[model samples]
Target: MPYLMRAEPYDASIGAVRPLFFSDLGFTSEPADSPSNTYFVRRIETPLAVRRSLFSGSAIGGYSETSFGSATLANDDGKLDWLSDLDWDGRLVEILYSPQERPALADFTVLFSGAAEQLVPGDEIEIQLRDLLVLLDVPASRGQFGGTGGVDGTAELRGRDKPWLIGRRRQIEPVLINAANNVYMVDPAGFSSLLAARDMGVTYPAAVGDFASYTALVAASLTGTNVATSKTAGLIRLGQKPNGRFTIDAEGVKVSGAWVYRFADLVRHVVTSMTTVTGASLLDVSFAAFNGLQPAVLGYWCDGSSVPKVRDVIDQLADSVGAYWGFGEDRLLSLGRYDGPAATADFEFTERTIIDLTPRPVDRRMKALKLGYRPFGVIFTADELDRVNVSAADLEAFQNEYRWTAVATNAAAAGASLLATEEEGKTLFDTEVAATAERDRRLSLFSAKRKAFDVVVPLTPGLTVGHTVKLTDSRFGLSGGWRGLVLEIERDANDETLKMTVQG
Candidate 1:
């Protein structure tokens, strides 16, 4: 299967020119939005060796493990050496292909897209490409520490030096003020002392044991930094305006109250907040796709002290609600659920269409799936008392494997029906209801005998991860009506083979 591949440079431009003598005639500059203001694309076409792999999670609690592929260009003529120019550093490169059998250049299709990594010129110009997900991998710092004697106040006591008199204190200023909910987001910045656990204010230390006086000191430290909203179920209520003396103690405020948001809104908030803070071009958010997601709520704490990777945060949030994150073929990051695929399969592959097929091993010997979770509205930690474990077992089997997540309260309900033996753990989720639901959902998925297949078919365009498709194999008893989720795709333009890793 012969094909032609080309790489188009991003942000390439040439200076616009006009006859110098025409200056007397006077000409207006092209508006920024004008079509005439477009940049020139000097297409780079050369002998190339490339391999591309794309992936997405097949179920809840899974994530893409794709390392955006690589390409090598033959620079025998030195014609392509210009790619070493500093101007091309970190540029977006669009890879395109045209079937040798096709006659028209217009028929060319976008095979892959990515940001080019550093380029080192040599006999062969090698280029590394990274997918859009790379943007989400940036480390996000939520709060800045002022150290011992800076903006955060000193570590010493104001007057005397007794244990109760001298303790660390913090005054949290608003990081983000959401007028829609009257919520002021503040990065706790590792300040562990606060009192209110829920909307109804509860006094500190009294609820957290004998540190009442110390809790008072911590509460007093955070006098003005509080959730300004009226008391509501599951929402944080800090000191109300005029009566600004510290009200909540550290232990309670640590898990105090999370600002509840619709799953979609929460995702947007997190992504936008990170992008705005870090200045990373995270592409665009699929608002409509997220809004169409199943009904769920996310409780997010503003404790940015851990400095987690954005990808982990988003993945855990989705997993908590039986959802998964996927970057579509178009490179748009979207969310989908293991249980809630499209009502109908988008594509179907039959014996006639499948060139090669190998079924993945099925794990039926597993006896039970014990999923661990914590009650809602609590900070994630290794505390055993703060966690709950629920199991889904097949009495006939003896094996047991445990998966833990900090973000799921209803693990029992949101788990997928088909599960694999190995799964990574995450800590995120605010309520037991969500955790239990997730546990049940995973138990159902893990207890069943799930099957996956490595399939190679003729170049199939428009195939993407997370989309459900039907498969039929008379020998395997698949009637074509059964749908499987696409977990990974490897496209080899050289051989015209489109390989897929699918699970059902």
Candidate 2:
């Protein structure tokens, strides 16, 4: 197998990105051209190698540890001296492999592709690459406001027309009314008291994109009264009326406007709007897989104090609905529901291919995990019946109200505990029925055991994380095949070994 490497560096002289190709086929000899499938690349003798680490965790809310590793190239002939004049940051670098024995193959398998972060020139050139997901790290505001010219979320949108919040969304109380602009500068922190009052039964004030009127003075005065038992029920009812300038909806309130986005649409907005380090725009993000999952209505409030990152919005949306997300080999964002394994195995690793395999069972057990949304201060505990369990000492919190079910269900699926974790401080679910449905979903996926493994095998070309692998190991058991979801993959040019973490 011969490896082909391609690097695209921005050439200031040409005022455009220039692509350079290198190969490991010719050493200590003159450069020669060799065909790799349909494309012919230059083969040079100098040392060239790459190490890549990729993670596409199969579980919703699962964390991925990403490192694209480094690529070292030979520069002994000074033929690569021109690289010093080019910008390395955000340039494209890719590795492709083709087996000579498999000449029938028409294309080289793209082993890795990412943005080159740095270049250290010497006899050997070392280029550091970073995952493309880093593109979404930009601040999540539609536009900046107050201090300087900011993003205007209402500006004509590109791609899909789904409206998204310019900043954070909260259960706001109008502290100041800009009667001149018909805008309400809200006190986002004021609603906690009303939500914490169990008797208030705080209703979603109005339809989305509509403003509800209220007064800060009236809300503050009613805070101390017991709306459930006080004979002054009439006075307590005054707090829920709309006499303020705040825009209100079932999701929350925004200062100047409302953006009630569907779960999938919000995810797409953050993804498509981001610009990658390579100056590549992700305007073509694929959402066909995303729209197939369970849909929910989600929104947020944006203020000077609370600007979100694009990655954060995607994660929050995915985690809220038991979905997983990652960039695919196509370099586009992909999302899927974490309900179960893929319907069919992508490939099989049996005795013929597997070198070694070992089971790694999680031992940590939990008695209870408590979580709460910050806004409503409603707390719920998910308890697991086990022989040994730990207490809910670490309290988890979320920004949105309706994420308890997703969190709990995903926790249970991850083998953290047989029961889903609970939130205690904030209530994301507004109705008992909704809360119960979330709890039931968590219960259905609960399990006392989690199956995971570390597998060692020869280089598996075209293998990507999140793909299913059917394993058959006669050494451990019968010849029956077992399906497992690929979570993480590690491989280097120094060896043919591919290390993977597989969960079933």
TM-score of candidate 2 relative to the true fold:
0.66
RMSD, one per candidate, in order: 11.9, 11.0
Instruction: Name the top TM-score candidate.
Output: 2
lDDT of 2 by residue, 1-504 (tens): 677677889999999998777776621212343433334234333322333333233333423334467777778777777788899887788776665644332446777777787888877778877756666667764343232111111222222111233222334332222222222332221111122211112333221121222332223333222121111110112233332222222233222233324455556545544443231333233354455444334444443345567777666555444555665556655655544357689988888889889887643333333333323222223321111222233222212243342334344444555443433323333334444453444345433344678888887777767678888987545278777777677765557668887776
Each model's lDDT comes to 0.45, 0.48
lDDT string for model 1 (1-504, tens) is 223333344433443211110111122223542223333233222312333333243333445454465555566778767666444434555555555453233454666655556566776666676656666776544334343432232343122111110011122122222222222223332223333422212222222222222223233322333332212111222433422222222221122244324455555555555653221332244455655544443444433334566676666666566656644446565665666335689888888998988888644423344444432222222321112221223111112122344332224333443332434343344344555565657655655556778888877667766667788877566864567777667776556677877777
Clash count of each predicted structure: 46, 32
Candidate 1 worst ten-residue window by lDDT = 160-169
Candidate 1 structure lDDT: 0.45
